[model samples]
Target chain A: MVSEADSDEALMELVKSRDQDAYARLLDRHMGSIYAYIYRMCQHHNDADDLTQETFLRLWSRAATWKSGQVQLTTWLHRIAHNVCVDTFRRRGPDDYAEIDPDTVAVTDDVPDDDRRRAVHNAIANLPERQRTALVLCQLHGWSNKDAAEVLSVSVDALESLVARARRTLKRELSAYQREICT
Target chain B: MTADEFADLLDCYGTDSVAWPSSLRNEAVRYAQVSDEGRRLLAKSIAFDAMLADSTHVPVAFRLRARILERIATNESPAWWSWITQSMWRPALLAILPLVLGFVIGDMTSELDGDSTDASMFLAFTDLENFVELNESTATDD
Candidate 1:
């Protein structure tokens, strides 16, 4: 009886042995966060879907290579997702990043909230890519600076600098949006 | 914590001291409570945290999760085959080794015995049916 109490490492040991049930449980446990992280990074529903799958597929294929305690499984998975997003971002033209990404296909409880969501989208999208990534990983996703830094392949100090700059940019952008809305 | 350190923590870890590294959390929270700058930064962090919490999280759609799981299941079968092909050599060699060792040891043991009945023992080197006929004829003569 594989319950939610099974540590990710335990599930992963089963996963390495090709236990589909265990893998499914792992997917159920993590798919939301992995998908959410990828979606927020790309702001495209289909791309996020594909990238999320790609991330898990990598997990399944590379299961044997995983070492316990070297890094947390979630951190490892997030790093894979990060790499997928970065590859995708690299393939896209720099000019493509300038425009507001279509509001994330994040399911909203209220239809009226779409406009505010788009405003948030534009605010995040307008920031420089690295800064935006640093913000998304640490601020929105609640990752520790060290883990987030590891994912970004940056020093913790550098990640801190990027997040500070990103926050300053997002604040200005959001304030501008608020002013425009009020006037 | 100094004002700069407090601000840095807020910048790097956002509003939640709970989410901050354990070593820094207590001091950072204490500083946030006592210092004006820390409080202001906490307010900003609070706003950001609220904004994030209120924002919609895009769940992995049901169909997408099913699709990925399905693919992984299908994908693993080939991997099992690949693993066998990649690792079978050692086992295969090990399987043949016992036979080779038996023949070598059988030859040495028979040589050590040096009995006239050794004719039967060396049967491996001779034609099997002829050896059988020779043994039958020798037995009849005896």
Candidate 2:
């Protein structure tokens, strides 16, 4: 019986041994963030759901392959989720990611009143795939540049460059909206 | 850090000084304070960061967690395989038992005196011939 107090590595050790309870606990610990990341990346609820499930399923099946100290569990999970989302994008083709209209973009009811946030969300959605991933991982998901770089399999400098370009684009796109909000 | 460097930091790390590389955070904060352009850039970065931080939170499907857990449950191996994996020593011991038995029999045979060994060897060969003869007789009868 693993307690909630167990570190992710400890739970993963048990998961490696086919411990369902430990696997369930790991799922509970990480499911939300992983789901949010997939949702943000793919921008479709159903696809995000399926991709998130696939990511965790891989975790369950590939638990033994995870080396404890080589990478943080969250970072490893993000890498898997990233790969799953990338595979989905490849299958769906680049044409599938149409521009997201701010008005039609689905968000929770709590944020409908914040036009600035919606605009920012739309701007992020419009970013090129790599830029969006870099920005989302660093800015929204709160991953450090190093960890985000590892997830993307890029150098830290390259990750920073991606994030810089993304921020510049967002700032340019949202300048008018920001001015309006200021007024 | 120069104002340009400070702005670059803002570009990569957003407006949060806490997220900036520790070695540069103090210099970046100092530049933002002393330079008008740095202040302007910092303010802009802060506003953008706030918008991003406040962006829509997409709720996971209410049943998604339960659905994943259920799928995992159904995907589990059969109980017997689960038992085998869970108690790996059982299979490992079973695997080595044959080799252990062979070694024990060889050890016993090696301990036999020379006369006793010859007699036992003769008895073994005779039993083998009898076994072959019985099989041949059975075939003739058939």
Using lDDT as the measure, the top candidate is 2
Worst 10 residues of 2 chain B by lDDT: B79-88
Interface RMSD of each: 3.3, 3.1
Best by DockQ: 2
Please list the residue runs of candidate 2 whose C-alpha ends up more than 4 Å from where it truly belongs after superposition. A1-5, A100-118, B79-142
Q: State model 2's lDDT.
A: 0.82
Candidate 1 pairs with clashing backbones: none
* lDDT (Cα, tens digit) per residue for candidate 2, span B55-123: 647775678888888888899887566555556466797999999999999888777657888898999
Candidate 1: tens digits of C-alpha lDDT, residues A1-183: 545559898999888778889899889889988988888887778888899999999998788778898988888898889888878788985666766544432334444455666767777767777887788888778777888888888899899899988876766555533333333
**Model 2 CA lDDT for position A18:** 80
True contacts kept of 2: 0.52
Could you tell me the lDDT of residue A80 within candidate 2?
Answer: 97
